[model samples]
Structure formats: C-alpha cells, structure tokens
Target: MYDLPSEFPEEPGLPDEFHDLQPQLLSRTLRLTAYSQENWFTGTDLNVYYDPTHVLWHKRPDWFLALNVPRLYNGDDLRMSYVVWQEQQPPHVIVEFLSPKTEREDLGRFYRAQDRVIDPRADQFPPPLAPVNTPPSKVEVYEQYLGVKHYIVYSRYTRRLRYFQLVSGRFQEQTLQAENPRIWLADLDIGLGIWQGNFEGVPSAWLRWCDRAGNWFLTDTEAAQQRAERLAERLRSLGIDPDDID
Candidate 1:
C-alpha cells in the first residue's frame, strides 16, 4: 500500500532570534518616520539589489531611512526594493538591531575611514572610517560599495547603541549619547528615541518619546491624548461643556 508523506512546516526566513524582535524594530522605525513631517518609507521583506550582476542581494536592514524622496515614484510603489544602481540614492541612515548571527557584520570592526573616497583635493575633512594613517579593511570596502552614510548597531544583549558616521567618505565611530539624547537626522530635522508604551495590549519600546511626565515620559500622540483628556475633564469639572468649544 502506498502511503502519503507527512507534511512538514516551512522553514522561517530568518532564525528564531532574528525573528523575535525584528518586528519591534520595524514598527518603531515606521512610527518614527510618521512622527516626522517628511514622508519616510520602510520595508522588512524587500531585497536590496546592490550588485548589478545580481550576485549580491542584501536583505532589509532592521531599519533604514532616506530623506527627500517622493512618497511615490512614477505612480508606482516608491520601491519594491532599494536598487542602488536603479534608484541612484543610498540610504541616509541604516540601523541593524543585533541578532547573534549578524552582529559582527553590522558592527564591522575592520572598517576604516581612509578607504572610501578618492582624494581629489588631497585636503578634505578627515575620512570617516579610520584615523589618519590607519589602513581600511574589508568592511570598509563593503560600506564604500553600499554608499551608506550612518550605520548603527543596537545590541539587545548589551542594551547599548553604537554609531558610525560617514565623514569624508569613510565611517568614523562616534560616542553614543543618551543625555538629552536625540537621533538628529539633519535632512529631516527629526529624532528617534525609545518610549515605553502599550501596543496590541502589550507594553513595548516605541520609537518616539516627545514629552516628559512626572519622572515618566510619554510619546507625542500619548501626550496629546492626555492633554485632550485633561482639558475635557477640567471643562466637565467647571460645568462647561467641551462640546461648546466648537
């Protein structure tokens, strides 16, 4: 007698650890973009086609941002995936939330600043990736190929943030800050931060926290709602109807 084979579940696109908090990172990224005045786009499943030979296919960043792009291109979706050659724009900022497998690549230690740009003038701002006299590495070459400006890696294991800025065509490490902390996107004039809040009935770390509470903090939307609720309650207490405010 012939027997049918038992069905097995399809394998996940990423490993268990990467899948866990990836959604949280994407959600925060979208929320931060919405908080900004300019429009921003993000995707989790899209493939970034970097190499024209179709040999190199990089999956989505945990989050990425490009400023001054139109909401839509040619009446089609802004992008199916970011094609550097086709789109002619590199991501202004890219962030990777650390997973065990990809942490090393995200924070490439061998990347040095002197390797990225050509010395047309011979006297430019210091290269971004390395101090003077320091030779660049494979990571530096990879970044030069990608044309990335700011690359960030946040460690869930350590709960720390590391930042690299592309200055003079090479990336330079900068001290990550939290005191009056803000992620200043000069192109958009916006910032990103963590906000403890509820989402889908669960407390989560949201990306935008625009107000201070009594030793607590609230997001811009949350704070607005609180203000509205308080004003309504005050009107009720004074026997003045909120509906009267037209």
Candidate 2:
C-alpha cells in the first residue's frame, strides 16, 4: 500500500557525516525513552502520516514517539511505520537531525507551505482549520499535523540542540539547564543528551555496551536480556533454582 513515486527522485542517502552516527543517536535516544516509560512507544525511521490526505507524507524522523500505546504491536514486535491517518493518533515527540537538505521542513514552515499546496482531498483529510476544543500549541500542531510532539531539531554541524513543546495550542521553545546536558520532557519523564564514550575500542557518541559492574550504556534489548540473566542468577544464589522446581 505504501509505494514511492516513480517520478519522485531517489532518496538521497544520508550524508557521510550523518549516515551512521545520526541513526545511532536516534536509536539510543528512543531506547532510553522506551526503557524509562510505560505504555509509550518510540521508533526511528518509521513511516508517519499527519494530514488526512496521506498524499503529503514524510518518512520517519531520526526518532519519533507516541505515548499511551502498547509498547509492542500485538504485544510482541515494534511497529515498522506509523500511519497517523491509519493509526488515528499523534506521536508525543519527534527528533529531527539537522542536515542541509531538511532543516527547513523539521522547523515547521517548510512542511506547512508544502501542505498548503498539496490539494488534499478534503473528504479524505480533515480541513486544516477545523476547530477542535483542544487545538494543539504550535509545537503540538506539529504533532497534530505531523503526528509528532516535542519537536527536536539537532545540529550535527554545531552539536547544539533545540527542543519545542506543544502547549495550549502553540509551540514554545525550551531551554536546557546548564547542570543537565539533556533535554527534559516532562510528558515522558525522561531526557535526551549526547554521551561521549567508547564502544568496542571505537570512540562514539552513541554506543551500546555494558561494563563489568553490570551497568550498561544504550543497548535496549541487551539491557533487558542482562536484567533477566541477573534475576535468574539471583534466584539460583538464593537456592530458589528453576532446576530444582522442575
């Protein structure tokens, strides 16, 4: 059902500066959020639809999030793509990596203008200005319109971060506390920040590795596995062994 246009130019692959690190950053951030919250979903590079037209579309953020949904689809697997029209909900947050090509769209004005010219099938898509009691804040509108909350724009070029939150039908920029390098999202009770560390002897900003003390970096699934193993070992040490029960 989801197909790219033949006339649509080939998706320019992510530039060398962004190809690897950006994905890793997005993945780790999503993992951090999902691990810390319940009934919340986080994804990277999943399809997302905001307008009813489904005609105007964008493919996944560096990372995106939806709150109050099953962490797993059907209780097992993560979602591959989010069709806002199909899903009927907006993501609570979105993160956009700054690249020369897409900084404008992520900032809101670009997509808004593009959406204006889209000639949406009104029947298929709701009127842009249809009044709703709780019209999202400008930032929230990005979630409502783009199905993303807490729009995050990060500049690899500058290593700087900017975050916006939806409030009372408008967007407001949030400033970070000097003590905390992470951006705080009160909605999710979590924070996102760059971590400088070593992984497999390669210095990388977003690495998923564990230390001897059983503390871990950003390996989501791996962290779960480690937790399970720790529990099993603890049970055995207490003589409440699974083998004995069997």
Candidate 3:
C-alpha cells in the first residue's frame, strides 16, 4: 500500500502538514445544501484524469468537489482516483492552498512572487506561455480542459482567499470585497468563509463552510462535545451530579 502514493513523487514535497489539515476542515464542514450527501463527492490530493485523448495526463488538485456523483466510487469502494470520463462529470469547484513551491503554478503566474528578496521586475505581469506540447499548467487543466466552475486559491500565510469563476469559456478573477471576503456560492446554497477558531487543538483561521446567515457548521468532534455539554447541563438542572456518576 505504501508503494503508490496518491500524490506521485513528481509532485512537490508530497504536500505539507497544513495541506493535510486544511482539506480535512473543508471536508468536515462541507454541507451540500443543494444535493443529498449520497449524490456528491469530494476528494483531497486525488489525481483527476481529465483528457481521454491523453490518458496519462492528470492534475492533482488539493481539493475538489463534484456534484451528482456517487459518495463512494461505484457505491462501494473508496476512489483511488477520479476519472472524468468514467464519472461523466467534471468538478464543480476546485481549491488550491498556496505553497511556496506551487504558488506560481497555482496562481497561473509565469514568475514566482512572494514576500522577501527578488531579482527584477517588481510589478511586471506574467510572461509568455509555454508550447502546447508541454504539460499543461494546473490553471490550464482546470480552466480549459476540466472547465471547473468555481476556482479558489487561498493563502494560509496571509489568510487571503482568491476566487475565479468560469465565464464565456474563460476563467475570470472575482473581486473580493474589502470588508467581507467570504464567498457565497449561491448555486450550491453553501457559503465558504474563513473563521478564526480552534481545530484539532490548534487555534488559527481555517477555511470552513457556513450558511447564508454566517453560521459555521460544526465538525464531528465539535458536535459531539456540544451534545455532551447539553447532557451535562440537563443533569445539573435535574439535581444530579454528573461528574460523580461518570
């Protein structure tokens, strides 16, 4: 089992710890109000095969969501990978968390740009594109081939979120409001926003799902804790010392 990794050796660094944690947060809080849980699927670090013509070519997105698909692959086994042709559906949303190695590819920039020392071209835009024969970039695969409707890029370092929507066969960057950067995906009937809280015993801002009213969904552990607290309070109200019994 250890022989084959979901993210091949070629992919950078095999992803960091935050990569593992962030996608878990997204998966836990994801409540597809538009469809039944049995009808949708989500994958983290899953290799998605897009082009049937070039069967070997694939893109490994950090996280992706697909609608009207089986919760389990073929309603039984967990998916090893997602094949677009076999599934007959492309992902509705794709999210990438920025890393130093993948920032340029994920952001569709010709040059790497982050804080600290730089050589030249402080404010210059992207340069020319590579030849068609070369392997397509992540953005190119998502935008042109897969045609993902909603593309999100987030930076944990800066706590910033960037959104892109497909329009007229092209990906257009959406302007996030200065005050409220939270995005409400109306079609999915679920909102995604950053919340500052404790998760997995760590306190930090996490990308989580919320309702239109801005209430973040509780995770399994959180829900369980809430239930236990309510039970304890009820016992106290009934004049029973819960701590003594447990």
> Which number leads on lDDT?
3
Candidate 1 residue spans exceeding 4 A from truth: 1-39, 110-142, 178-182, 196-200, 204-224, 227-231, 237-246
Task: Report the C-alpha lDDT of model 3 over 1-246, residue by residue, as the tens digit.
Answer: 112234566556257788899899998989876689999999999889888787767888899999999998888879888989888999999999876556777888423455322324434534334546777888999999989999998888778788898899888888887555788888888888889998888888889999999999998888999999999999999999889894
Q: What are the lDDT scores of the predictions, listed in order?
A: 0.52, 0.55, 0.82
User: Is candidate 1 or 3 superior in lDDT?
Assistant: 3
Give, for candidate 2, the lowest lDDT window spanning 10 residues: 113-122
Model 1 — which ten-residue stretch has the worst lDDT? 1-10
Clashing pairs in 3: none
TM-score of each: 0.60, 0.58, 0.87
RMSD versus native structure for model 1: 13.2
- Model 2 per-residue lDDT tens digits across residues 1-246: 144232223443243545455555455535433344557676665555555544445454666667666677655765656656655557777777655445545566424332222222425533233334533333334745663457777665555567777666556777865442466665555566655665335565542223333233455655687897898899988988755664
Which consecutive 10 residues in model 3 have the weakest lDDT in total?
110-119
> Which model scores highest in TM-score?
3
